[model samples]
Target: MKKTRNTQKQDYVIDILTNAKHTMSVEAILKAMPIKVNKTTVYRILERFAEKGKVHFVTGEDGKAYYALCNDCNVKHEMHNHIHFQCKSCKKVTCLPYEIEVPELKDFEVQETQFLMIGICDMCIS
Candidate 1:
């Protein structure tokens, strides 16, 4: 079977997110990714990823939006809620602010949260 643009984009979205060392904007994705697709393709791909609970999306303090792969490679993706760290220097994105225990809500379920910490990464330390 072959993948439609949607599937390819969705898969590519995760591939990009997981492979990326840092959180990336749509522009970054479009530029760095080899796929010769358009923005709409990226958006739909992201929507589906969000639908299946494969990845987490968050807006940074700078008002720029970004995405990250759920850090729980060993566990089910939905079970993880940790955020990503974007290093300002090398622009590497790593999962940080490790998972912490939190009380569960009764009414609404907690799906996921994307918290991005932007600063100079260890590689940038001089």
Candidate 2:
């Protein structure tokens, strides 16, 4: 058996995602990174990770994309039907533990689903 090597950029992105407490935008990710990287490169890496089920993202009402790790997904299956909570006050996005089963569509295959709630979070309320 052989293992694939992760690029330095990918490793850095993974480290950032793993340590992040809330979903982060591309700008936020770039600011948190130790070294500056091209915006396109960062987005590309994030897109790859999302496709691989390593990370997931939700677009904010403001039209910015926020990303978080998919703790339940694996290489064989991509578990991404988890709920997302976005704090209205702080504008922070958090991945909720709640997972829901998607209902089937007639003559159609569902590839992805997004269940997001926007409101004041506990931290914001306090």
Candidate 3:
């Protein structure tokens, strides 16, 4: 497979995700960017990054898709295999270190698993 070079927009998006404290929606990412970028362009870049395994999205408690950079994700293997936790109060989504293995069924194949836990975050509890 031929590797495609990342465009300027893609790089910028990756940088934003890398530095973000928590998962961000497309609109949030756009607003946080220093320079202006088209909404469509940002979405496209995110989609491409997701396909390449550089980033992944989780549905937050707000019913919005939140994108996050995979800690050690690369072109070859992009799966971080971590649990996603969304705070019920603040609606902040965080990646947890707990890894859960999916049970294989006799006649079914499990391609991927998206695990999520919704609860009050540490800050919210205090």
What TM-score would each prediction reach against the true structure? 0.69, 0.87, 0.82
Candidate 1 is scored at a TM of 0.69
- Give the clashing residue pairs of candidate 1, or none: 21-93, 22-92, 22-93
The lDDT, on a scale of 0 to 1, for candidate 3 is 0.79
Tens digit of lDDT per residue, candidate 2, span 1-126? 543333777888899999999999999999988877899999999999888778888877778889998765632334467778999899999988877787778999777676788999999898
Top candidate on TM-score is 2
Q: lDDT: which candidate is best?
A: 2
Candidate 2, after superposition: displacement of residue 34 in Å? Answer: 0.6
Q: Which residue pairs collide, candidate 3?
A: none
Residue 110 deviation, candidate 2, in Å?
1.5
Of 1 and 3, the candidate ahead on TM-score is 3
Question: Which of 1 and 2 is the better model by TM-score?
Answer: 2
Worst 10 residues of 3 by lDDT: 72-81
Which residue runs does candidate 2 get wrong by more than 4 Å? 1-6, 74-79
Superposed model 3: Cα runs more than 4 Å off: 1-6, 73-80
Displacement of the residue 40 alpha carbon in candidate 1, Å? 2.3
